[model samples]
Target: MKTVILRSQALQGATASDLSAAVQYLIGVDGGGTGTRVRLSDRDGVLLGQGESGPSALGQGAEQAWRHIQQAVQAAAAQAGLGELDLSRCAIGLGLSGTGVEAQVEAFSALQPGYALVALDNDGFTTLLGAHGGEPGAVVAAGTGTIGEGLRRNGERAYISGWGWVCGDEGSGAWLGLKAMRHAQQALDGRAEAGALARAVWAVAGQDRATILAWCAAAGQHGYASLAPLVFDHAPNDPVAAGFVADAVSELERLAHALDPQAELPLALCGSIALRLSSEFSGTIRARCVSPRGDSAEGALHLVRSALQR
Candidate 1:
């Protein structure tokens, strides 16, 4: 029965023929604030080639991000021995941030000319799709920022947290780093309990208190969030750092509860900081959550394949 269904699907695809002549390459691209990654795969989802580049979608403007995406795609295609291939022959699936803006989305959509089928969505959606193998689940990302999103079994979607750095992102690396720095500054000013946080920040920045303040004036939110690892490094021995982790875990737990009142579904943690703090953070959630099965690129490939299958 399964074989028959598979054969029928194959026949349907062949009959449709929209992508038959194009070599049916599944291309998945993930563009985030930090970087961009592209993956090329065969019809069966076997990854053929992959390439990465710096800060594609969020950091740069739409035109620049699109250019980066094109370059990464070209690099991957070339690596897969598909150099000089027609863009229209490829099925492109892009998961990107900052494209949700009307102007950006329109700009990106216009760049999809050569592809037979193109699907573009926020990178978070693709991350969730990849983490859960296209199944319904939730993901809490905690890199420069934090956000939580989930898809229920019935295809209903929910998002909890992800208010960005200033307003939200409770358990994110950015949050942790920000908190740590604040505490350190407070301590330096004799307003807070003394701990290793101040020393750690000074050490990481290789500067004294006055110099650190000057740096903060010019550094952006992400720059401060980059220091989160130092907090984790000191968590085992430093009470202030440990307190920050605990606070992060608490915030994430609140986010999980917001997504599901019952709060017992599987949640996947993505991004560098969330993964690093999983042991400490996961303990706060009663639900059965796990790490992502694959990266966003794989999820993007899955998206492309699903489009082709349809």
Candidate 2:
């Protein structure tokens, strides 16, 4: 069964003649705030090539997102010994960030260039599909930001806490990094206890408040997410850092609960920070968690295959 589904969608019109005339290829894109990745595969699901490019998140603008994806697709084709691939011969799948917004999803459809077929969905849900091999399962994507996404055995889907930093994304790498930065500030001002985490953050941003504030002001989602390892390194021994980790864990646990109250579905912790923090959830949540079978790119590929099968 295909993982990607749209409430209302129109597949790129293609006659059987067109699909049969060319040696068709499949392209899968996993586009998020940090970067974009593309996978190229044959109709039989054999991976031929892959490539990567700049950030392609929906919030980054529809034009830019497609540009990066096209670049990656081109690169992948080249790597596969097929250069400058004809779009008409390909089916593309995209699991992109920020598609949770209705407008972003519509904008995507509006701006799409012609292809033989296309499928798209929120990155979080795609990750869930990838992790579980399209089976019913859940995923907590805790990268620069966080979102809890799941698909049920019966075709239902659910999402939680994908709002950006100013609003939601409670247990994300950005959230943890922001918290660690705050602790660094407090320690410098003699307001809070500082440890390895605080020292590391303070040292990196300069030892003074003015420099630190300037760094904070300039930090974007990707920039803030980079600071998470410091907190992770010190969370066990530093009270301030520990507090941040504790809160983040609680929020993520809540994400699981919101998606599956009975915790019956298998869960996969995805993205950089969440996977690293898996050991932290030793009890209820961890008990039901498993490693993802694949990543978002595979999920996108699955969708592309599904579209072709139709």
Query: Model 1, which residues run further than 4 Å from truth?
Result: 1-16, 19-23, 110-116, 204-214, 282-287
Predicted candidate 1 versus true structure: per-residue lDDT over 21-113, tens digit per residue: 554677898887667899988777777888887656643477667778888888898898888656655777777765435676766655544
Stretch of 10 with least lDDT, candidate 2: 1-10
- Provide TM-scores for the models: 0.81, 0.88
Please, what is the whole-model Cα lDDT of each candidate in the order they appear? 0.72, 0.81
Clashes of each: 3, 0
Task: Give candidate 2's whole-model lDDT.
Answer: 0.81
List candidate 2 segments past 4 Å from native: 1-23
User: How many times do residue backbones clash in model 2?
Assistant: 0
Residue range 82-199, candidate 2, lDDT tens digits: 9898786777888888887777777776776767677887788678878999899999888888988888878888888889865678899888888888888888998976678889
Candidate 1 has its poorest 10 consecutive residues by lDDT at 1-10
